[model samples]
Target: MAVAGVSANRLELLTIADAVAREKNIDKEIVVEAIEEAIQKGAKSRYGAHHDIRAKIDIKSGEMALTRHVTVVADDWQPEDELEEFNDSAMVRLTDASKRDPEAFVGKEYIENLPPFEFGRVQTQMARQVVTGKVRDAERANQYEEFKDRVGEIVNGTVKRVEYGNTVVDLGRGEGIMRRNDSIPREVFNIGDRIRTYIYDVRAEAKGPQVMLSRSHPGFMAKLFAQEVPEVYDGVIEIRAAARDAGSRAKMAVLSNDSSIDPVGACVGMRGSRVQAVVAELQGEKIDIIQWNADEPTFIVNALAPAEVSKVVLDEEADRVEVVVPDEQLSLAIGRRGQNVRLASQLTGWQIDIITESQDSERRQREFSERTALFQEALDVDEVIAQLLVTEGFATVEDLAFVEPYEISDIEGFDEDTAEELQARARDFLDRQAAILDAKRVELGVQDEVMAVPGVTGAIAVALGEGGIKTVEDLADLATDEIRGGYEVKNGERTKVPGVLEAFNLAQEEAEMLILQARVAAGWIDASELPQPPEPEYEEELAEGEYDADAVFAAAPEGDEGEVVDDEVPAGDPDQPENA
Candidate 1:
């Protein structure tokens, strides 16, 4: 059949394939393959269905060829069930093929040429759809390959449109979307406006590749500073940590490798130009550039800058710190609605409790008196001896009971005889306390199963029984946090029971051990079992994406856990005005 413009035009085909490949950012070979497949399908439609059809395009000359392929098979070989139907068209017996070509042998393939035919309207439409679909699939694959590795990078794009609260950005070669929550607070962009955003995530979905962009991410601010500060970019200044409240406020802790250079000053730039540039980009978000310190107390003080801290008492077991300032600076340290202290906590990765100096002093004296009384009553000692024990850092009877005789004797004004006698009394008092607790546990009817759990002392068993957690099963069902710190509810004027850990003065690890033992005793877990958490799958290869200059600065070295310094600042004089 004769058809116009249906036969392969080598030059035009090659030119079209090249244009499409460049436009779609796909390999030219892929486009050529799609065209060849489309042509083969059209040829099959024109020729007899039984013909074995194949097609190829010459890369250099743009020549297209359609051929029928028949494989030579052994005469004794039987055709499979599915192959039996097309055996005559797809394959030829070696004996039969030898008649046509004397050199024909098994495994040899014979090719027959077919004249080019014109395409009908329907065939033309089918070919168009096939090429279009193949090109689209290739384009999507290319897009996924291009952007998958670009996650966590900052990219520039123009706003294409806004749907609901989400903004779509045209990234030249692709498109990205910034969800409403990922955008900085109160910041808006108009159509065609160019903007930079951090690529927090990229995923390949059935519809297309989804590039998630963010403007309020902590990494975004860190990257911005890297762009503005040469020292940060060059690795002389390192950003230890960053926390952002979006368009309101942010804090960054930085350290300098070179002693002569100040990290904060380097980030701030001459006359604050460098930081101002970053602030402008973030819509005037106030940023605090802190001098990072290895000493945690010093770091916290720097993080809560603009407000002076008179003292910081860290509770290492609880991972909490208490900061005391003058009464006048209380509001400043706490910030408006606690924003200052909250940012400080985030920056330092610790829980912070701010108090006035007077409040701290009162709490301190109360704790001292309680310790003194505890030592006096437990050791049958006078107030002077108890005071001495308390001042020597022995805050509880347990300390004296568990300590070596030499340790007690080392205390000022303590003779060996006196220390030995005190230790004996402390041990006797603990024994009496334990017996009383055991009696209480029995009275409360705590199960033997609960008592058998490791770390579940008689006192803890009694406390658990009073709280209505009687059986091993009940204890096993509690969450780690619930077991470590008991929940509390206050209604109008009534206060419910606090957590078991707080009630028994149990450490977090001790509570966890108790729960683990409970689980084992309840037959919920194996006796020798260890927790097997699923490991995170991370891509080890470096992504073919833009470099994140700030990422290097923000990457913290392992084993650099900041230490708490024992240094203390003098208490602020309430009568004197604070330093501005």
Candidate 2:
């Protein structure tokens, strides 16, 4: 297109723009706009700089036009701050504009045609540079918009270059980077090698879109299975969870919507052909396809497949599971370096501890013996009766006292009358224990404010008082960690003592609740209000000089200064002198 007297074939200009847009993978409209802008710059150079010039291109016909624009304003109108940049040539007063066009009115735009310009070497080069830069920016924006929503999907690309163990892949229209850590262990890539990677993230950076790819991400395996397994892709089967050691072994939990179709079998395919394809892509990484279970214990058992679990004891509060397997299955359950159990824990979202049946039996027996002894001593019961109580799952005197009479009577070898008598004795013993704790609390001078805090019973008050936390203020000052485990000094070394929570037989949550309650009772915080987290304390550097105690004390407010000053007395008064 010829613009501002420049001799350029309109068809050639449009052809070049179309080719550049296609080559750069940018929208054609952006290229056209860039060309129009370049022409405008050239036009402005030829015409007066004070004139407002613009250029437009016809996409189909490749025709170019340049026009000068002037805004009509009232004769008395003055330039505001925003319009101050425009010179008189860029604006026309209504009276002056009306001389040329009688219909000209204020707030109307006046357009004037400008002659086409001759193309000079500098102008042509400048236009080309502008077109190149604008095309590049358009390409970047297009790539970002295209790939932003494709994160967590798998894409195929060719390795373009490798820098310091980071492989840059050319994804046809865009580029991606796979860091060394994100690749499978021992996996290597060469230039021009075709590879598939998971688009874990795409960031719009200052330079361009940063597409981060990964081969070791658990999602990568899930995506691969989706490509290989029709059932997963169609949603008949769902992959619940995946955990990978990457190139060594991996675990996947799959569930099926149709109970008739086994999720694991569907993922595995007949004779493991489908799974083998995934394994080959992952460089022979072992894949365990286990059926997912709604029940956590059952899921945990499935996660640790090939290892027979005899029993599972769940600690929901801690989100941990203790799995007991046969003695021979112990090694398999733990796997090499505990990889099996580790992956199982990750897959089930719970901490897994494996023990052999024999070990579990021994531990159970030890606990039973300890509980039997405690019941015998605390409840004044014989060894046989204590054993019976322990066998019935009554581990403490409190259990006997608080349990329903029917539950106590239901225990084998215990009649209704015997159960009632035992319950009465248990209650009497607990009453006596409470009285003793009350006396100890009083002797320790435990404050009623501390005792009144929720979760702080007579026993806990006594423990806190013994630990030198005798008042609500002292208790309130403790952190959650400190309340859960008291600070201790051993062998002149200060350390946090464990089992403080266990000493009160309280859970960690309960210990924190008690600390919050104490803080509220002490007026340090409001009820149902969360305390503000303490800010980090920075040490102040003191100036080198003799310390000025008076300057420091004088700034404190009233009682905070530590000595009361009489308002009636003037400083250095002879009759009434100040007391130090």
Candidate 3:
């Protein structure tokens, strides 16, 4: 009866391991191995801690085997640690083993079978902990493997719990976390409440894989649109861009491959059903469905929907645009708390500045007067001729000085002689300015070598001298940020650091070029080793659509719609103030 009871207990051990393996979704072999380790520990506690004991469980037969092992070592063998030196029952000197066996080798191992013993209270607790920990590690690994590849896909989950403004989601197979900011504003989820979110990122953390979820990510709206719109799912229409203020508002740019279908119409659905479905999901977010245009300016116009844009001035170098709207539409164009323009800017990937038509007109008049005055003073010409030149697109003295004579002569009321006289006077004015700037540079003690850098003009040299950069070496030692003026973080607070030529408003590339040229001139670097400048990006005219302000001006009849026209002010101009 005692032998039968021992057999039953062996089978029961295997049963418990199989049950745990199934419940934890781990390999049965792993469970058995953990049980083996637990048994080894308990045996050590019972058979003296010095013995090298081990345990193994049979896979097919429900039997557990125990063994005590002693390894034969060479005379020169030493213990790995002080603890091992004191616990040397597992090792037998080869010379001593040879006396007992007459053929002992350095690596020979002798094993002894051991009887199973009853588990003490401490032993049972240790065995339970070992099994639980191994199962948990396996579960975490399983969860990570199952969900890591699912990132960027929308998922449905139940709210497991909420802790400190973060919601933990039980994704049937794993768990995901949606932080407070990731959730739509003012939206809340209760325990067991079903919620849908986008898996933006998956990270393997020390405790487990962190599955990050978000309802506010731009991708979330796009994915929701895909689910509701068949064309999007079938790839007939593509969501080009998306921006969201979460629950408040969003703008989505969509394009259709087929010209027959309107991408915006398809996304909006019949009577706004499809969009309404998405809006319901996003807590009534007002969506602007913009029809994507190859022309970035036109796309921006579409992005700022429900608000009329009279004109758009694009500065491609800065990736910025200034939009002129009717005076009455300013509040609507800017939206509630500037949300509309902000979303439009995000959708078009451009920095957008909105202004009333009156404001734009006033600024244009100011620029026109400024340019006319500059031309009048520099060319020593009458106001009428300067006004005519300004009207014909001449904004600077350099424009008149270097222009082909015929171009100016073609202007209304201007002849070849008049153009020549203007050019000569403009050249004289520029020469005088250069002389003055050079005198200032000399007074400031700037070295002549500083002017030798390819891009360094007299004005730049004067500015550099004022900024305490007197030599090419000083300029060479400076970083681009020092010359371009960038933000610095001091004690976690961002502060603007003024550049030596900050007033010049140089482009980042331009500043880098100046630094590289200075370095080459100072013999700090070879001219040939300098990196080539990037090719300028030119905007393509919109596909059978003109999105440029120049196009708008040319198409519209003057004094008909009172449309604001672009003044053709280039960005980074020293005389022009930023629209921002």
lDDT of each: 0.81, 0.81, 0.83
What would you estimate as the lDDT of candidate 3? 0.83
For candidate 3, the 10 contiguous residues with the lowest summed lDDT are: 571-580
**What is the per-residue lDDT of model 2 for residues 10-127, given as tens digits with 9 covering 90 to 100?**
8887778788788887878898899888888777767866788998888999888789999998888865787575468888889989999999988899789888878577677777
List clash counts for every candidate, in order: 2, 8, 0
Model 1 lDDT at residue 75: 86
TM-score of 2: 0.70
Report how far residue 10 has shifted in candidate 3, in Å.
5.9
Off by over 4 Å in 1: 1-8, 36-55, 64-130, 148-153, 380-384, 442-453, 463-482, 485-580
Weakest lDDT window of 10 consecutive positions for candidate 2: 571-580
Candidates sorted on TM-score, descending: 3, 1, 2
Q: Once model 1 is optimally superposed onto the true structure by TM-score, how far is the C-alpha of residue 340 displaced, in angstroms?
A: 1.6
lDDT at 373 for candidate 2?
A: 91
Error of 3 at 531 (Å): 3.1
For this target, which candidate reaches the highest TM-score against the unseen true structure? 3
Span of 10 residues, lowest total lDDT, candidate 1: 571-580
Candidate 2: stretches off by over 4 Å: 1-13, 35-133, 229-237, 256-270, 410-447, 458-580
TM-score of each: 0.75, 0.70, 0.78
